[model samples]
Target: MVKKDTALGTGTMADRITDDEFERRMYSHDIAPLPKEMEAIFNTMPDFVVRPKSAKEVSNIIHVAQRKKLPVIPRGGASWGLGGCIPVKGGILLDMSTMDNIIEIDGDNLTATVEAGITWKKLCDTLERKGYFLGAYPSSAPSATVAGWINTGGVGIGTYKYGGAGDMIRNMEVVLPNGDIINTGFDYVMPNGSGYNLNWLFVGSEGTLGVVTKVTFKIYPAPEKFESISYSFNNLKQVGAAIHDITRAPINPFHMGFGDAMHYEYLRKVGIKAPKVGSLLTVTFEGAKEIVKYEEKVVDSIIAKHGGKSLGTEVGAHEWSSRSYEFKVRKMGLGAIPGEILVPMNTFSKVLDDTAKLIKKMKLKVPMIGSVADRNSVMVMPYYLTDKRKFVRSLTTMGFNKKFADIAFKHNGRPVGLGLFFACNVEKMFGREGSNLMHEIKSAIDPNDIMNPGKLVRTTTGFGFDAPGFAMNMGLGLLASVRSLLPRDTFGEKK
Candidate 1:
């Protein structure tokens, strides 16, 4: 039994917010919906939704929730397909979109401060106008919010050189679980003091520890020259070798990504001349003219050594400029479910081969795409296009996604973001000792369990056999059974 009015309904915070604003917040709840078939696993919805335009308002809302012992689920742009922003326990959905604002651009310090809700693309455009740019941004930059990506463990566009969003953040203002506002970095007057890197603790915490209100990110001067190059490989092994050699070299490409045959087929449908037989690797460089020239020479040498054929700059330029087109194509179907796993550079080929085999065995239609995180690891993202409204197809997609995660785990890979979907796989990725340490930290900071409960760490009480992992496995088993019963070509051929 839960108290309605006292815990969630119009109470003290109602006095500060208008009814229209509250209703508006409730209307725009989530961007992505869980598979219709997995209702039993994740069907929780927030009781109240509140949009806070300032840190003080956020503090007030959180304070009331704390007093009432209610869960506080923070939300940004809601662009992520994962269940990171969903309210599992359903209490107050803190919509941070209203906090969108670019606070400052410290030219002398080469840093910019902006409200967390601001989109990465907006920030990039703002910086570009001033001859500056972000070090890295996710593929969803156009719609994903700064804090959302920071909290979700962002990795995409510029990871090859600049690393993930965590690497770009210099400082932040975070509102702790108890509504206390603290600056992760030094005070404005003394911005370079030595202290525990608290800024990073909240970076990938997924709002379980705190809500990031504002962020200060390191910025760099806009490059004077930019170039894109493409290469073709006869097989996954060749592509893997090329990536490994390029990543291990002294050259630092701005971005490096590869796609399997299925991905290129989709690209071909979109009027791009992607090779049909094997894999396509694209690399982009941005810097001084001399640096770009040197990096291109090095990349070409590595590709040649790996038995890769140069496709020149035309294909690479088109692909780089139209990177977002892939997402558009993904959505063209009923819906696309993406499974991302980060694996070591050496095992990239092995993982790809294993996943391809699974996809083939399951008769799943998914396109494999990946980007080199750095010299040591790569991020593999395979998207399954399915009609979520169709139970059998949706179940098949979900089951395949779980299998992909399992394969990644077996190959020393972990999920890029531990949203509700990947929460159960934490123990497998990080050993028992590491997982227990994380749980301990979560308990210490959010003892009340009012912050994003049921995510990162399970909060729902269950019997010994009803652990989250067991439940997920059971669901996967059910899905597999249903899929096996379905007729061949029931979901139709891969588009």
Candidate 2:
């Protein structure tokens, strides 16, 4: 039982704690609805929610939890549906959104430091006004927090050239599970001679190890010239070849994204006038005008050699400008089951083909989006959009989502982030040795298992690829057939 003392044995910081019903309900889940089939497993809600304004206050709260042997889950904007911030074991939910502050922008060092709760859009807008920008951001930037993305190993708009959030981070201040504060990266004052890269460990640890209080990210000057071009390919193989050739070329693109034929069909239904068939690839370039123009010429030649037809600059520019809006449109009162799989460039074509086969076998129609992270890898996102009010459809969607993740795993692709939903695959994702090392580190830092206990480690068993049986598959097929008869507008629209 939690101590009812308002002082919390740590003085004034205890006032931040609350067990209000309204707040607990609000913090219960994320954008993704809880699967009805697994409702009984995750039925327990958080016992209390705490909002800390400063690192000192956070330290106090964590120390109390450490002593009480209570679980603590750190929360940011809570925009993602991956269950990364869910308080599964009913303890304390650390709401970090209240710590929204941009602390510093060091022009000389080309770095920006901010509190954990600040949104990516706010940071990007602030830096753009000062003639600087983030190296990369997530698609949910408008609502996703800096620390949240850092914990999830985010990738987005500018990833093609600068890599993911991990590559852009220079340093960070983290509150350990035991309430001790430590600074990672090169410290100008009181440097430690450990010679270990501790900063990267927290990048994708999903907040199971500690609470990130502050982050310093490497920023870049705004590009002088920006241009985009689109290409239409007749087949998935051609699309893969085009991406491979462009990535290998000397020209570095600011962003590179593509959609399969089904994705374009969905766009057309939403009145975008997208192509009826074949794949669409969009490439955005930045830098000096002369250099951009020269790169576009070379890119055009490469696409032509790969059997791609130019769709002109108008379509590409429009798509580039509207990339972020897609998230908002998809989530407008609709149920969406989204998953991201990271695969090597060489297996891009095979992954696409295999995913198409699975969708066909399951009799499900969904839109898939792909992005080239760098020369060697790509990220593929396949999402199912359905009416949230339909109970059968929602449950079926969850089952199909698990099957899709299994397909990615079968093809040697791993999840982009391991939230509660993907916890079952931790061994497959990190291998036995890596998973054991993670467990060892987690045990050392949080011996009592107070920090996000059920995530990133195999501490609990719940719904996953093995949960639902043949009955769920039959239900999914029936629901898919019924959904086919409904109008496309039955799903939501951007407005």
The best candidate in terms of TM-score: 1
Error at 334, model 1, angstroms: 1.4
lDDT of 1 by residue, 356-413 (tens): 7877667677778888887888899998776767766676657766778788788887
Q: Tens-digit lDDT track for model 2 on 36-78?
A: 4444666336778888888878888788887777778899987
- Clash pairs, candidate 2, are none
RMSD in Å for model 2: 4.6
Weakest ten-residue segment in model 1 by summed lDDT: 458-467
Please give each candidate's TM-score. Answer: 0.89, 0.87
